[model samples]
Target: MDRGTTDRTLLSPERRRADRTRLIDGVVDVLVIGGGVTGAGAALDAASRGLSVGLLEARDWAAGTSSRSSKLIHGGLRYLEQLAFPLVHEALQERSRLVTTIAPHLVRPLPFLLPLTSPVWQRAYYGAGVALYDALGAALTADRGVPTHRHLSRRAALAEFPGLRRDAIRGAIRYWDAQVDDARHTLAVVRTAAGLGAAALSSARVTALLRDGGDDAAPVVGVRVADLTDGSSFVVRARSVVAATGVWSDDVGEMLGDAAPSLRVRASKGVHLVVPRDAIDGGEFARGASGGVATAGGPDEQRPGLILRTPTSVLFVIPWGEQWIVGTTDTPWRLDRDHPAASSADIGYLLGQVNRVLTRPLTPDRIIGVYAGLRPLLAGEADQTSRLSREHAVVTPAPGLVLVAGGKYTTYRVMAADAVDAATEGLPGVPESRTAQLPLVGAHRWNAVKDAAPDLAAAAGLPEDTVARLLQRHGDQVGAVLALAASDPELARPLPGAPAHLAAEVVHAVTAEGALHLDDVLTRRTRVSITTPHRGTESARAVAELMRGVLGWDDERTDREVAHYEARVAAERESQRMPDDRTADAARLGAPDVRAAV
Candidate 1:
């Protein structure tokens, strides 16, 4: 029940071409229009029900908000304060499933130290809330993946996280949640779907919806797709079209020429900061229980991440490899949805808030990466973006188009199932959602294969730690990466400038992970873009060359890929330097996207 089907796991260049040709030549039961988590989930959901599904993404998978999240699959403790019990309960249940069953290797238990600034009343109030959260997890989850909430004294909390300023807390509350490599997890989902009878194609942009009728009464029959890879255009017929485009939901109406569904999905920009472990006061806390970098989704230990309350929202100090992931200011965003810019003021505000409790405050130079993502919230009368609803809505303004929008990352599966249910409403012999029992591609055999990391590393002449990290990222597919390294001695070497990453990952990004461009390899496939201070500029050229043979990129094309990625990184750096969003947006627009086919 847990094993992924053997449809087509390797999404190689050959696979992409064949799938594109197949999609152009025939019709699918369902066509998913986004490559983010939700769209990937929708494709999986429909495909699992024995329906033909075609997934299309303008860029690589998880190219948008899915890649740039807080990276926590949590129950949202703040939502409890707002009395959204059902949402919290649902998220907690999903968290339990992900950690225990669905993606154990990709999602894991992460402890959080919530330093309390107030006295007994504040502790009592928050204590009850956390207790309720644990109770919900206990009731919903059979295995109960994470530890129960533990109340910690100020001294005890300080003993665990010495990075915190001593005077900032009266006491502390430690709770357990889950963290995921958001982009990797999303990729795994899409890959699993592809492995389970789904035609997956990235770099394919849907130009317009094809319909039989010419008027508003016309039902969508297919999509006019433009392949960004070859600048080729084609059309694929579909019985149902599910649009899980998140922040780009409004654009569907524009695509439909004013006949599309009316669903207001407002954008809330959330900015994150990636800083080095040494930037914090505690040095030894950076090491995990497993003697490697302390990671949120990796093996858990006394190394707990920090969660502090800010004036507007909560700020998290998450453990990500050698760096700490600090984030998220929720404010309205009306600019470009593709790449939401994180301005200098945004970073300043974030640092200023987190520094209030940090014994060793981080400077601007301390930040290795600053990325921003937009949250698609269901809009209502509330003007503030934070006040908008996180619950999703499914609508069919036309006969064949199903629009699902406004849900949190934690509830993506539920949203996708709901969307698929709507899309396949009148379809014949559709079974119930089987994704609950379906494990992603790498997850099924990970538990059995995980402990063999050291042995496998020995056989491959690589470090045990490298093999270990590979298992966590690729799960059971660690062999695929290790084989690449074993075949090529150069790939076994650590990537230059970003030595934390191995060169083999670059090649694997192309052959298996659907990485079409240099940006896809650096930014999403592996986290070189965010982890390295160079923003992947130093790794871009070597990475491009590694991918050249796999993708048939000649000398000039490979050079262009490297150059394009460098320019994009420069543009992002320029954007982050600007004082405000408007200027930042303008600055970020300096380097247009490399795939300008659309």
Candidate 2:
């Protein structure tokens, strides 16, 4: 399809209204529950195979574990220690597929430094593991987009990362992995699937499962979905249903009636802290303290990133634009899943672990944002959550229902392919998965569009950096966003609070992306919530006003939306200050869900 036609295929409000009608009218080949990365991938895989598909999500896309990931697409380096060679190998292959052909715009290469503490044995120990990691990646994909690993001397390591305390590290090993805006990548997958004729709907909850024979022996046939936006329920008939809910797998499994779930999902909470890049970098902090003195090469130029071995788990201090993302704490969590609360202890644990290696310590005041997510781990004999397998499993507890669980974000595509493969059993003429070779909506002509970024920047009257950021986020679809700016020059202006994003992008979030609420736009559609000091509260009103035109919200509705978003931010901030999970959960629950309130 042409670009304009493709843009029209977006999950806009009009398309969503039409999709609801079509979903209730037709019997589709496959119905997917959940709109996270895996479910989105499943929709794309099934739709591209010529199967009629519909995907439904209870909340916004990537509102769960998918958005709050460590954001690295790597063959788990630590998985090698557990001898999960096959798992690591598979993830490495998928990583290459993502960085090269699939969604190159969203995913890119990033360098990491693994510091050497002990002199000789530490270097050799890490060197062999990293070499094997690189070798596995090279063997799996012909063009492993990332570079190989190399060793650095003590002096060389210090030169590369001045943030590391000289006494803390002996040397360092440099390696390459890929990173992504996880939420954006997930949304792009959904958009790509929708363009391929898949029915994608958010804020639609699966209230119950439909049966063909109305008994325990009966096969699962479809689902009764409740439109959370309008409080209307409709039945979507399908030949098969795939439950891809991450942490809520068991809850869906209950819909099987008397059939016991073969697998159980354990929630492991992981929290991340977003702080200014200068917080942990000594040189930048020193420069800032000295009346904004300019440095030749900035803090990021000096230190790419760092990964430290903590007592509980590995801590990664990743470079993200003008900010640094440090995390994460892996602990057992049985609290609320909708809003996983990161307690004061969780923040303290991360800060202490990361501070162990840093020359300049990071305090609570430096933290701009904090988010917690749960990993849907397969229940195993291992008591510790870290020991649970990263490998995924696909099970058919009933004739028509397929459940997929227990996989890392890096291997979501493989998990989705497996789920669809299981769901297509006994069906005739279903084609093999073509998603591996199929690039996402914006990725098809990304290289050509990226090459023209400079000219596009000049024509649009935007800084080259702004255009580059747009290209990385939107790929060839950047033209559609630029078109909005062209028609209204004001749309080209940067957002007042979050200057990294343009106002046009906010409008695109509503018109093109399936952003049903202001929280969806601020937190998931863009990184404004995490990147800004006010947690996007300062820009919430402006974004809501921009969205009002597209959504047809009146003045009162706009005020309500902004107020709801602000309440959510306040609750999150309060939760972060709480001492324990119990108090944190209570604090987070203080913010009423906008859908529920409506």
Candidate 3:
């Protein structure tokens, strides 16, 4: 695509307003509610099938469960123990597609080591399971896009992961899975959908479902949406509507009243802690030093990510830049959906589980960031959230309305395809999903751009590492970002308090990524909020000032935006100190939302 064509497809400020106007003035074939992976995927799928699509989200894209995933694109290994063969097969196929075709730039291979606590039985048990996992993947797709699992001796494993506790395990099993920057991948899906003629709008919430007739049995036709940005309300008409709202599926069902869907969605909160790479002695193992077993950290030996089983859930210490993302506690959460709080107890639990295997125990002081998100698990007789199925269900609660719930992050494309299929049930001539063969916006020319990273870095007067990072994050779209910096030298400078990102990224976030608020740019677009120790407060003012130029914000609005971001950071920190969910939720609620203030 030409520069102008690509720029026109961006979720820019101008494009957002234009799309919103067009959506209100005319009816579309499909209207997708929710900006998370599933909804974005659905929009792309529908638009690819020659359907007129409009996607709306109450907040920024991937602002919910989508952004808070474990960042893995693996078939649930534990599901194999549960005898969920079909689910595992489906996910492995999707993972292959993402790594090989759909989003090669965003999703890549990541190796994981599962320690064997009991020498013989544990090793044999895990080996058999992993062997089956590999077999399933091979059976599903010809292009598996990842290496097979391998067994390692104690000495071999130790050489690959010197950080592992010597007494904790006898050996280990290394396997290949894929990982992604979940938020960025979701955003790219939305952008790709927009490029394919889908009208995408953020900060617009669907409040009510519009029906063809006033009766309860009447088919649903449209939605009444409130623009959270300006407190204005409008109705968008569509032939069909699909709700991929994740944990908020129940809320949308409630809006449907007595005709509500039969599905029950239970919210399970999961939390992750981000810490520096050195804290975990990451990448301490030298390649080819022992038993010829390569470390599973990342493409380079720079990141040797690890995974272990806990009493309640699996714990993953994944490599992400200079830091490792350690997480996840699955527990029932009945608190606020918008800002799920991570209590002191949750943090303590994760630290305790991870510290069991780590040579050095990580304390609260070492934690750089903590994030909590809710999963919309399908309610079943099984009381444990871990027991809930990862398979998704598509329900046509009413005619012209489809509700999709209960799927893992890796299978979002499948969930979206199922949702759209249900939405267009009776409509003739709607083509089958083409997203599996279609590459995301940045993936088309990524390989060429990656090969030219060194040249691009030299021309832009940046380190090759910086150019590589930009390529991984934006793929071939890095040119647009560099173009901004080329015209203004100041935009090339690294952002204060977040040296990994450049100032031009902040500008592009507003101009091309639909970052309307300070929170959107910091939290989702750049990840400064979860990576920096100050939770992005140190850079909030500077980023707000840069955004003001594109957004046309005056001094008063700019100041308020920065203050709101700071308050949010403070509230999140305070919440993390609380003992339980109730107290943590109360603490987090102390911060006022910028939308409400406006």
Candidate 4:
């Protein structure tokens, strides 16, 4: 009733805390650390339950492991071999929820095919395994929407994928899964949490955890936060804390002193290469005759065991918008967790695996982009790193400290729910979680909006493909973007170099979404950084010009943004050429951020 706060907007910074409140009031119901998908999810969960939530990130949103993932949302088929039935089943359930109920706009079913190498027993064994995979999913949800597994004879497989070596495949098997833009999904979760009244700020690191061990271990009270954008510090108090830092969970745990639990999270490095779609001959799902095995999320019938792969991780070649995404080597990592590099060895391994099955081989010259990310694999006894369970844990080390770690990208929601539940242990009358039923910002009534995509396209005077792309990226939010275009027809034009992206989206990222830097908009908001021919460099000037007014960048800042982005692209290109992590990291470090690194 007291209009004490200035900005009443759901996500405005002023609504964060009253001016009278010292940054160190250090008193809130929940203080969530980490800006990955899990941390964002935890903030949304806690805030939705009527808890005073403040989420702090050491870097930009999705800056770490969240942005660097295989970008798939699926029940782990590989888990079946490990006999982790429950984990697989749980992930499958979450996957279904994401596609149908949660974030349909960002997640979609992808198809993949697994070619059979051996002649007889391999085909039967693999077929049965795939049957089990499909049947498991079918029982969990009505109309899982993913097509059932399909079997293909040797001739049929070869006909479907002519790029495959004639002698390599005895037959084939196919299955289905889902894929996503991991970084975008992570940011969406964070933005949705902000919209729900969560105090979410990135580029702010938690320097210390306040412990009142003398007062019956008063629930972790607050955190010392350092603004990475500028050399300033503030104290944010909270009644409870949730640490959802993925591979870096140990750092957060140490802040809790002796109260920190003995938790181990292994880091597994995975690397991917981006190439032009035309560079590799491939089918729609690599099921057409042009490719060896197209891993886009379909059942494979040729192999002994059913396998489902995406263009992002499969041994087969698959197509992205105008490019192809390939390779994913799961190897142990013991270096700086911040910027994982794709070594020449990692690249060679993937190229070798894919080339073994392809009629034409992929060379280094064809690769345009490469990215590497570390997975927070739950540690296990020796000889089991790759097999480590993905089930996340949320443990309270001190009165105010709740540390969460070790979960797959698909199960982030569940991990978040658990972390908030841990943080609200002694809080009075906290409401139950509403995230399960809460559609993300873009998910409301997507069905209706999708049906109207053609009309929207006609109105924008763009091709249907452009409209469909917008719908996939923004869902119902497309209306807001379209309205902006209507006000200024110039906003309706496609961004240079990235024809699929509308100029309005770039403007929207700055004005609405919490994108404070050029990298934020290009790399996360629009994904032009990874999915483009020039890796977003070709469109850098246009994007910088569009943001000139919103970000208040003068000619110098605009030039700095463009120059920074170009250097970044060049560094990434050079990093891809390095033989090992040390060399690769040096190349990447050549382009330091204009602002201080978080």
Candidate 5:
């Protein structure tokens, strides 16, 4: 009943404790299972609709597919090939809302170059398609700030990006799409939901679907939860339950003894590589591609991100701050769901595809990071997972239970609205979704904070770029982070090993953001894992030491956390060396999950 607490927006250890107590004690209007983008979005949407909501995550937010996406917020240009026009249009609208209204600080436009290898018909076909794509975006929303598509000559394409081989193509088409730090975006959604009176907690797993009389065929009433963090178990009562569990959707169906799946979600593994900006061409790309700052002016105007048509799916060489993200092999995967390992073969496949256009090839030694994520695709008569629909399905297989599956990263808000609509279909007088107008935690004062960066940097005795990046990552919340740095002189300096991030940020991740472990802070909260060459290994112990006091960890616990992280990195390295998925899965499983049994 009391929603006026200052700690509501802070996902601190204290808040987690309080929310867990509240979850155990009270019956909520809606209970959401999952903490990825869609689940977090649903929580924010439902809470803003004036519902008492409970959000539970078996792990940290976006720990799975959400964090490991291609990180693009677009209408899926390739979907046009499938003629999924309505899906494209809906995604375009959501993309506009994210850029202009909801998360300008987090989501902004980035340009891309689509090379035409066969100059004549290829140019006409792709040029027309791209023109339609741009027109669709413009028609849906007035000037989303994404530039219109432009035709480029062979010479002009080389001028824009010299990464392509000289003899590779005839010309190119340049267009715009948005990019985001997906993990942070998901965390912001969670915080925004918490601020709106949703009791959100992570590292909490639902072991069973609770029934009133404990009958197998009885309608679901609540859940039996296991706290993965502390090894405690509890019960939760809710009027309705929504499973946005993604690839794990079928597991939810099994809990209710439902033989039929409302939404058949097949796991399609998408593997990506993070390499230095120079790796594309090695020399010319180093000079041009690393030009722009992230989340602000965007990646280099001349050296736009590349979209190459693979024999299977589209491949992207998207530019980040100092690195380039080259990715995504979409093949059916039937391996471990928690950690989808990228095998040497997957790596070879991606490298082999991107190398078709590159003047200089990418080698394993040049890779900074490797990650794999499973896409929850709707099962269809089509054999290939790529042929599966991007549109989501929501259904109530049993009374008081809702399952949502099969959607992409860009349209999570829409998916959330639909899931909430289905979950509360019988509940009278529930208001329509208010999330379209709502901005996440850092979005509110982002514009003003961005403009004040130089002054804020000077005042804080930090570099302008550092301040700007902080503003970009935390949005209006930069002030809170700055306050932490000002309080202690020692925390103001750059972190050891990972100089791009401040020492204060490691502290803030726990105190304000809901970072329960080293993995949460380094991997999701800051992206130290993917950006740094050592993949957060060199920075592990130091980060743990910074968080030790805040998390009340003794020397043993601190050392254990560091050990788990190092082991995780080592296991990932071994996995990447493996030639196939089964071997990679076994290698990755060498290091057990940091979380204990429930």
Candidate 6:
């Protein structure tokens, strides 16, 4: 009955080693390499379908592309411009599924405004387009929880959004989409996979693939893994292998020694800048559109992309909890694939675009947070990365190896399903996937429990706001978090510098979420480092203490963690100030991770 407190040691080093041992001893049904949203989803899918699954990641879960998304879970309405109806429809369906069924707490609806430059024709045009978007959602989920689109005159638009530029808009068409905390969502999927009996390991790097039978073997029988935390190497055998690595997909394919499986994948870098809440005054779902509004819906529709005035990007801003997150530039990137640094040009481009329509201009001093994510664009024609398809492709050149590439974040679940389906084709006794109806680790009956939690909130001595925050992050498992605090009341205290997060969360990340280092906790688990002005300095010691018990860190280890964290923050700060990518990359590399002692 208390499945809520499942005693699975998901992130423990000992449990990870034991799981790795199990895979080497008995062949796993599927071995998933990569820990982003798609790979994490694949692990959950395979395990839920009764396949013995082993998932290995070189770094922490969602530490790569998954964590760096624009954090929206919506159908690609822009794809409609390219006449990519199937992709839009599929993404719309997945977005609805995530909000209504899968992880409602983590994903919620956000309203977007398409500011019309011309009232009459544009309103009719965009209204029909958004109507179609709503229709697609209806077809996807008959009772789509989101409201339909609405048209507003210029005067009405300005009245609702006083900060808007008077001349930039003719009117506005507001429509609904969804947003999510990307890293949290990915972490949830990985945890869900572990709960479904998948052996999950982080800080376990896959160095190479070991072919079965011979060098020219038909299927990849196993992978050679190096435990990065310790200097040890081992082999993990599986009946089928899936490479769900995002931007690194092509490189992973290279390891398999086959003619690259014609995946047109390219990495496009997108950046989001986080600013103080004082920078924007608007609700979370506020939206505005521009010139292309009227032409968006017709059969021969082709219009200039409408700008979303997001934090530091277009001045079209929305309230995100405590801060205003702005930006997102869709520019081509040619650089080292992993850890794409935001170039000065990229930042300048965003600032220029966003400042154009803002009543008050934002200078570089206003920036408190900056993150760049790579969109894995399925590559396309000469000089056009934007034109590349967001559609996904799965190719199996060899029997044991499967590669999935090129899909939007909203469609990760769909992409994962397809990847697993292809990879598990030859696996013995693999049951049909049941993930469609299965709830994630923390999500089962969440709504019902959350609806009935006022008494529980009072009993736990938590304010309503605190209870709501806990339920948002932990879903139906808030009771477990409460129990953590019950064992030690200190866990209930808010993190020193980060009032929004509880110390219990930092503890839980280590105990359950596979956060191996302090950076993992600060940067990914809680996001205190990026969102705060001190970048988690004041809270580092507090969080370090929370980790000490779970990770067996001595005083010296804790000091080193804190020192490394400080250096990392300093380096990132320096990186952003640099004038170019070359300088930025160098600045970022100034703080190398402290390697485990030999």
* Superposition TM-score, candidate 5 onto the true structure: 0.96
Stretches of candidate 3 exceeding 4 Å from the true structure: 284-299
Which regions of candidate 4 deviate over 4 angstroms?
1-26, 213-219, 285-318
TM-score of 1: 0.96
**Candidate number of the best TM-score:** 3
lDDT by residue (260-302, candidate 2, tens digit) is: 5779999999999999977866332111211111112331232
Worst 10 residues of 2 by lDDT: 285-294
* Cα RMSD, each candidate: 2.3, 4.0, 2.5, 5.1, 2.8, 5.9
Residue range 218-306, candidate 4, lDDT tens digits: 55677788887567888887777788998988887776666667887889888877887667655443333211111222222121112
Off by over 4 Å in 2: 282-303
Expressed as tens digits, the lDDT of each residue in 1-598 for candidate 3 is 5676587569889999899999999999999999999999999999999999999999889999999988889998888988999999999999989988788778877778888889598888889999999999999677788878889988878877778888988999988888888999999999989998999999998999998887778988899999988989999999999999999999889877889888999999999999987788654533332121112332345345788999877999988777889989999888899999999999999999999987888988999999999989999999999888778999988888999999999999999999999999888988888988888878888666755666999999987667777877898798988898888988998899998888999999988888899999899998899899998999998899899988999999999999899999999999999999999999999996677664
Q: List the residue pairs that clash in candidate 5.
A: none
Over 4 Å off in model 5, which ranges? 1-7, 214-217, 259-262, 281-302
lDDT of each: 0.86, 0.87, 0.88, 0.73, 0.86, 0.75
Candidate 6 lDDT by residue in tens digits, 113-188: 7788764876787778888989988896565756677787878667655656878888888777877888988988
TM-score of each: 0.96, 0.96, 0.97, 0.89, 0.96, 0.91
Candidate 1's displacement at residue 41, Å, is 0.3
222-299: candidate 5 lDDT, tens digit per residue: 999999887889999999999999999999988887434556789999999999876764223222322233333333
